[model samples]
Target: MMALFRNLFAAALFVGILAAFEPLNYKDCKSTFKINSVKADGCPQENGKCVFKQSTFKINSVRADGCPQENGKCVFKRGTNPTIKISFIPDRDLPKLKASVRSKISGGSTFTTFSLNNDNACEHGIECPLKAGQTYEYTQSVEIVNTYPVVDDVQVNWVLSDEDDSNKKEICIVFLAKITE
Candidate 1:
């Protein structure tokens, strides 16, 4: 009876501690894009096809980790949901937009894609299909794995594309993140 009572008390204490420290949310993480730079024009090619015109969205900045890091590298803690903030200018409204993140480890790679809209069910409250000629900030949240495949550098590639026709890419951003234990 005494052992049972002690075990119950310990379990209660653990639950209380977990409740006190709320799980990391989207608002907690940061972006990693460069700041204060004029948006550049470029034609991105995917699968050997490139668009003739410049990208509709001009990337202004991407905030990740604590501060703005070069080459899109950011720092993040394990077991936390890291939010990436990207700012850009929409030269034109996109009827359909597709955003994806590709994470590459030593032996394998995985990609997760989402379409911005009300039904996307995004955890960070990101809505898609931006307005034309308007500047907007977008946030992407992802769960940082806590264990396995730990490396000094991880390549994170973010891509935005138009789905109206031919699925032309709008922007491609890459960042290296150091995941701390």
Candidate 2:
């Protein structure tokens, strides 16, 4: 009887650990723009930002069909489209901008390119000639095709560059994701 109780306790502890969702980890690749916050469908929002614990920034599990965390990584289902919203303030005026999305699997040096419906930032949500120091919200839908292999620990990178000078990146963000069936 005592052994049974011990086993039950151990199982419960393991399940609890798995249920604790870690905060989304993101980085500004170019450091040219200030990312105010990022959130998906089910994350809690407050004061125009996603509400997360201060110390660890742990997020809660999302609803079904929404981007949820499993094994401490955000899960994106194949053949489904997930929308991501980002708030940022650019340092310089961006008269024209182009968007690019790419993914790099774990331990892989080469990145696979992905396409958005329209590569123009102005077409998506941003107004033409974005003013500096003004916060702007940009929303995009990522199409996860059925052909993509089920991969773990994939680095998804999104960049907005100047159409005139491709080298000048206005904003660059990289986040971790997992693709599942």
Candidate 3:
């Protein structure tokens, strides 16, 4: 009975810290392939074959396009000024990248992935501690200054996960996506 009570107490404390959103952080996904929104014209349907979504929703600082199962990247034309912003980032960090990575876009299982490469401050690490039933957020913006005419579509996807078990209590993925064109 005493041990049971002790476990309950610990669980409560963890819940409290997570509720506070303590272990919070973000990763700015950069691609060798840059994006240029103005030149790219519009996010393609059938890969630039469709009209841009026209809604009055709030636009996020980062603009992201959907990732296709077949395409390895979200493409953009070389001269089209790259827009390398992370349109949607989860409130929590997912598992660390493995050379033999296994990932599914938006819970779907057509595993299409790539190696995560980056710089300091946005290095390989974990961020967590966002309460269940609560929402936390992070945003990143990058201008795709480099554009190649050869490129066609620009695809992106976001995943919130708790791959780091060391900090069991601190785990989250704040979802942030582009709301405007």
Q: Candidate 2 residues 145-172, lDDT tens each?
A: 9999999888776667789986766666
For each of the candidates, the C-alpha root-mean-square deviation to the true structure, in angstroms, is 13.5, 13.5, 17.9
Question: Where does the lowest 10-residue lDDT sum fall in candidate 2?
Answer: 55-64
TM-score of 2: 0.70
Which is the leading candidate under lDDT? 2
For model 2 the local lDDT of residue 116 reads 90
lDDT of each candidate versus the true structure: 0.45, 0.63, 0.27
Question: What's the ranking of the predictions by TM-score, best on top?
Answer: 2, 1, 3
Which wins on lDDT, candidate 1 or candidate 2? 2
Candidate 2 residue spans exceeding 4 A from truth: 1-25, 43-65
List TM-score per model, in order: 0.53, 0.70, 0.26
- Put down candidate 1 lDDT per residue, 40-146, tens digits, no spaces: 11211122211112233565554443322323335456776655555555566666555666666535566533223332212333355656656565555566667
Q: After superposition, how far is residue 125 of candidate 1 from its true place, in Å?
A: 5.9
Q: Distance from true position, residue 92, model 3, in Å?
A: 11
For residues 1-181, write the lDDT of model 3, one tens digit per residue.
Answer: 9999999999999786333221112222332111112111123223222112211111122232231112223343322322222222233334332111122334344744423333211232213332222222322222333321222333333222233432321211122122112
- Number of clashing residue pairs in every model? 9, 0, 38
Question: CA shift at 141, candidate 2, in angstroms?
Answer: 0.7
